[model samples]
Target chain A: MFEVENLTKKYDGFTLDGVSFKIERGYITGFIGANGAGKSTTLRSMLGVIKPDSGKVRAFGLDFEKNEQEIKNRIAFSSGAFDYYSHERADRVAKYYSNFFAKWDNEKYEHYKKVFSLDGKKKVRDFSAGMKVKFSLALALSHGAELFVFDEPTSGLDPIARDEMLTIFQDIVADGQKSVLYSTHITSDLDKCADYILFIHEGKIILDGTKEDIISEHTIVYGEKEQAATVKEKAIGIKENAYSFSALMKKSDAHSLSLTQEIPNLEDIMVYYSKGGKR
Target chain B: MSKNLKRRGTLCAILKKELFLATPLPFYLFALLGLMTAIPSYPIIVGIGYVALAIFNSDGFRRSNRDVEFTCTLPVERKDVVTSKTIFVVVIELLTLVFGVVGALLSVFLSSPNGNVVGLDPNLTFFGVAFSCFGVFNICYIPGYFKTGYKSGIPVLKGTIALLLVYSLVETAVNVVPRFNVIFDSLWGDFVFARAIVLVVGVIAYIILTVVANRIAQKRFEKVSL
Candidate 1:
């Protein structure tokens, strides 16, 4: 398990302000946010790939700054932007990567490579995007990492591959000892497997909880467009067409009680927020 | 410091990886560079190759697509990243110098003039000048590249300018200026004691410059978003 508290980063036009979250062991936490919502920034800063202006991170009962390499040894991190060493063969990259961690197991890497159908002699470019992700996971797993932090790992992958990745994530945490945290715009993937959801928007985490809890708390109320004015002010967010309107709000705060209230899925929640929250 | 001993990988791991990733050109070029030293009437441009090494590392052929990001994911510190690359540069400098001395020895015994036409003679003092140039290049290039973690072109350009001035001014003062002739031939061109003083001062300067460059590069790379 890991926790990041009050992580703050500032750039010229954007600021990730007081962002904080914690992930429990034995769960896949889906990080859903619109593009440029500070998901990658938070992940990089958490792993110390980039330094945050200020933050406190604790993982496996160790402080990040005080025990970076020790903590990194326990965590497997990959981002979509990571595709260096493409010209090198998988075995060679693994050999180089293996030297860094005392727990690195070549056998496990060999096993995963076989399972992923990755040729050892092939360069990274020879593999598909999905295979590349699996290759990174193979290296991370061989290193005995307890926490897997991936940024948009499923992006550009076909649905079948995405589903397979979800299954692999489940398998990783099956022993109730490991954890997986992934950020993606694909909410359907989370609906199928994520036990918990952390939604970030505009550099802030707007909502976070168990998937069931988050879904149960919010509902989408739909009605004729004529009735939109009545609910617009009360809805967390609203999407209105010329014919009908769908508004998201907490069930308790819902004013259009007579209207049909549909259970909002992860995508619905994300879309509603993206449409503009609290309007 | 107490926790450092507990870390699994040491700087050795990072250094090994660097060599594995870097091009083999510098090693092969070292010997040829020494041969360049034996060419009479040519300027001792051995430092030029080292300058080219900095530029080579910055481009697509030497590194491609988010190499910095991939490196950051490894079980290493940001400080280690800068330190390892700096060490790699220093290793290249060492190799070039070793071959240079070999070439200087060949020049002394084989009766070939070692590029004294327009610069400092291919002597111990020539090594001093090369060392000083590399020191300036390290400060300008290494830290400059780490500022954004991907831009090496400008740093190399600045380093080229700085080293050019050093190369030209030193070459002129020693060869064209009549005030400095004893260091070149007082005890045989490459063996003069005065040349040793220049050599020692240049080595010390290189050490100081390289260390300072490492510190600046580490600080800049830490802030880069990678």
Candidate 2:
């Protein structure tokens, strides 16, 4: 239930050019992008952490500016690099935030503390990186939020910790009422958890769709000189080999052109699309 | 919700955060220092009290990039956020006055006035100096909150330099011109009364400046990109 309309933000070195998107309720949406792709910028604007140069961000059918407090109360956000008040014990921080958030569930926080194996009495600075990430997620989850926005939530976690995180996310989405916007470079996690993928490049959303539609509906073409001519010039980039070429075109076109094979996986598609492949 | 209540809630949040970090250390240090000094130079002691309050309250403004980003994510309005910070400084100023008196009392007891220590009016003079220092602290302290994203290092350095320069200039002028004491004498019969007037006037000036800073801080925070 989030909509970003004609969101334009200009900076000295980068510009988010009127990017627009809608996140359906009851689905995990992955904001996928490489470094410096403006994914963090877009997420920040959505959370009202930073003001956009122009345009509107609507959450839960309300303008962010008008219903900021209400929207914030219903949503929880966490990032991998984000830190808790370091000198504060996790328990102390929880106590402090209990007043700020109306729906802060003390039972849920206790449950998470055990599940994450975090000592609530220990200062946050004493926790390991994985522990810190888990602590942040615990805080977000304990707030009884309807929507969770995670920015690279599993970046620094160990493999086991990352798996645990994914499991928690899966459990969160099982109710079919909650939603999440998970921004991460980890496509594998998205493949396991995200229902929708929005690929941001520079500042524009270059690709947006469900995982199946994004991967299965498209085809990557690789062939010799003759096959290169079969593809449209505008859609093709430089020919890598004398008798070999690769291009991205519709799968339907593949049947018409007698194509070779379909390159599956989100990563390949992202690489192909980012490197000037078009359809 | 009433706007005033909301503002107060926001202010409470900021004050709580600051108190958690710095309530006992620097705040109590002043009391300790005052006890050690034993109330000899009332004016200097009051000035120290003011600076201590200002510095302690000002710590909240120093934040790393991550802290700023996290804080901005809270639901509070930008104006309320800025106002809450200003309120925090004011609360510290008020607390400083209370502690300042306690310090003065300790100072008076420990000094055990000797014959050489003459012309030291312990009653009115001590309270007046302490109160005036609090007022001066308010005047100098509130403006820094308007700075970008609660940063204080620049403000702290600049404020210190400015205060020193002003003090030096005033001292030089009063010394170079023999009739300056005559002008001062006409202003107030004694130092205590003059300091009291300064305290009152400074507080009034501080309130006005706080309103201005609140407006500017609110406007600036609103435009700040996350």
Candidate 3:
């Protein structure tokens, strides 16, 4: 339902050059990138919060510029940093938000408030960072949004909160009418919650596809230096530790059973690709 | 309808947030009116009361909140958010005018002996000036709001410094030439025209600032990562 096409933005020190991606109506798309990789810029352009220097963004098949308000009603977002209204209590903030958003579900807000065990009367600024992230998620979900765009939602949370958030995200996408674009440095979260992974590096998308397609299409190989000759020119980075070495190869070219071993993880592949498939 | 058009509630949500931020200004209006009504002179009381209304609302334009970052994320257009805030300032101006006039009229009625003649026309000048003051507030505020979400030190600091410079310039001009006031009084008949000019300038400036502010908001919002 969301399409970001050839989006470009420029700053004095950084640039997001012709980035493009699409999120299907129901799948969770994880935007994985390192710091300064333009992931956030892509998200902002998609939301039309920042106008791309060039190219068009279509949400629900309508141009974002022409139909910004209409499209916004069905979308919710939580920022990378877990900040909230410092002076207002959590319940008060929720109530204030309810007045403007007709779709806001008070019951859902209340339910999540309880689930997260947030004290309704406490000012948001008093809450810990993890608590703030939970509150932000609860608020986003309570709005009954069709799309959830989270910018590093798991940044400051404890492990338990992170696990709980992942569970909540999985449940959120179960309805199939809902979609998400989760941008984060946490590779593990993508493994658990994302269906499609888009890897951004140096302001461009290096690789993007379903988890299985990426993992299945790539294989990890290891042995002596002579085996490197048999591998494709694009070896996805090699690790050398004293006596042995390991390298990743395209699975289509390398027979898995014949290869020394296979290691599959989003992080390994990202590191492999970012290093220009060197081995 | 396009999917985006089908889901347009985000703008209202943004306006709601702005309204909460602005609601406290009206209380200042009431307090200023109460203080002014206690004064014995009707015309003077009325004129100053109107000025107080403008000033009270101006105070609301003083600070900026960084929390605007949160609001910018919801699916609302930046223009809509700017429009909502502009509408909010207009509402505050109107409410202040109503309260100032009522308070002035009541003080005149209560304190005057046997319905003595008192000039109510000058109060219209007061209204004009107050309206202009509200206009100035908006002009300064809207642009500032977009630049820093009122949180960063730059926009507000610049506004404050500019306002102080303007205030000093006006004060200096008023002190320098008695001839200027006499000439001004002849044209405006005791500052009515001056207040009217200010009111008009304020409004024109407000409109121009709003358009600029709207564009700035759109740009800033799009650049916002979250």
Candidate 4:
């Protein structure tokens, strides 16, 4: 449903170089990267918030530049920063945004408001950080959008709030008619909800595949220092101590070695790949 | 709704939001000051003050990081954002002018004959000066605001300086140059045709400046990275 091709943006000290990825419908795609890894930059380019030096972003089979209004109408974007009208109350915000979207559902907004336990009469500035994020989610879900693009939606939330957010995300895609592209540093959140994973590092997409495939195919091996040296040529993201070492390797390769092999998680894969591990 | 209707809805939404975000105290205070002043040029002062207040309020939104968040996440085109802003300014300018005219007329009628109350003729000149100030402000402020997102302090400062410089030049021409003085006197004299021509030309200039400013702002804002 969404695709980015050769997206490039250059700053004085950083450059997003030839980053590309595709997100399909009916599932959540986790855009995971470390700080300054260009995840936010890529998301901004996809939304036309940041103009790319060279690229093409296609969403819902339409070019972003040519069909901005239509494309934006069919998608909802939210950020945890919540830079919207902080001085105003939730009711006022809803009233203003309601006019911009023809598909804006008042009932859905009310439903989410109750579910989130938000008071419409209170100024947004007075709300807690978690409340602000919940307010943003309420707005995003009320517009009947086919795609939801979020930037660090779980960053400042408490454990319970984060869990609720993840559950809401799952519920959003439960019908298989909508999709989500969520960019976040919280790999554990993705392990619970994301179906596909796209890992970016230093302006490059280091890995892209199904979450299960990436986790099941890669093995983390722990062995003696001498054994680590023998397998160093084939290992990825090798970490060493005085007596023992651990490295990431393919399950196929781990069978040949007499070392303890363990299945990896999203965080393990991200750590290994970001540390120069092979795909 | 249809496409045009949706576009209009979006514009209205922006206008509504801007109106709510901008504090009206400055506009009201300046308008009240203009109403109480005996000076014939109070309208120009008030108009310029209104422009400054608008710029300051817009910059406040940017400083607080609300503008990017509000505008970028909205389901509207960048051009729509520019258009709505320009429309808001135009509406405010028109309201200011109307209030100025009413205050001027009231001052003329209420003051004693011996007092320093001005007639409609002098009030017309004040309106002309005020209109010119608005034109210059629009030319400077809109494009500058668009190019820099919402950090419009520099643009507004430059616009005010440019307005004063242009006004000083015009004043010098009328006072110092003989030929120009003659033309100015003719225009200022009680000739209905000349006054009508000046009014028509001023209206046309304001419209042209507004259109040009909107176009430039739209183009610049389209390329702006949020």
Compare the candidates by TM-score and give the number of the best one. 1
- Positional deviation of residue A253's Cα in model 2 after best superposition, in angstroms: 4.0
Q: What is the interface RMSD, in angstroms, for predicted model 1?
A: 1.6
Model 4: colliding residue pairs: none
Q: List ranges where model 3 is wrong by over 4 Å.
A: A225-232, A256-259, A277-279, B1-15, B21-65, B87-141, B144-226
Show model 1 residue runs off by greater than 4 Å: A277-279, B1-8, B22-31, B46-50, B53-55, B58-65, B108-115, B185-191
Candidate 3: tens digits of C-alpha lDDT, residues B1-226 = 4544433555555666666643444444543553353244343334333433443344344332344455566555555666765666565546655666666576555554422133222234334444444444445655665654444344434544444444345434534677643432122246656656755765565466556655665565444443
Who is ahead in lDDT, 1 or 3? Answer: 1
Please give the C-alpha DockQ score of model 3.
0.33
Question: Which structure among the candidates has the greatest DockQ?
Answer: 1
Q: DockQ for all models, in order?
A: 0.67, 0.43, 0.33, 0.57
Across A221-244, the per-residue lDDT of candidate 1 in tens digits comes to 999989888887778899877799
Assess the local accuracy of residue A202 in candidate 3 as a C-alpha lDDT between 0 and 100.
Answer: 85
True-vs-predicted CA distance for residue A244, candidate 4, Å: 2.8
Model 1 achieves a DockQ score of 0.67
True contacts kept of 3: 0.52
Cα displacement (Å) at residue B114, model 1? 9.9
Model no. 4, DockQ:
0.57
Per residue, candidate 4 scores C-alpha lDDT tens digits across B1-226 of 6988878887887777665554334543444443432444232353445556655565675558456546767778888788877886776677666776666567566544433322222244345655676777788988998896767788788777766765566556655787644443331344545545655666677788888999999999888877
Return the candidate ranking by DockQ, descending.
Answer: 1, 4, 2, 3
Question: How well is each residue in A35-148 modelled by candidate 2, as lDDT tens digits?
Answer: 888888888887777678888889888999887877887888886644757766878776766655767899999999999899999988889888888888788888888888
Ranking by TM-score: 1, 4, 2, 3
* TM-scores for the candidates: 0.93, 0.84, 0.75, 0.90
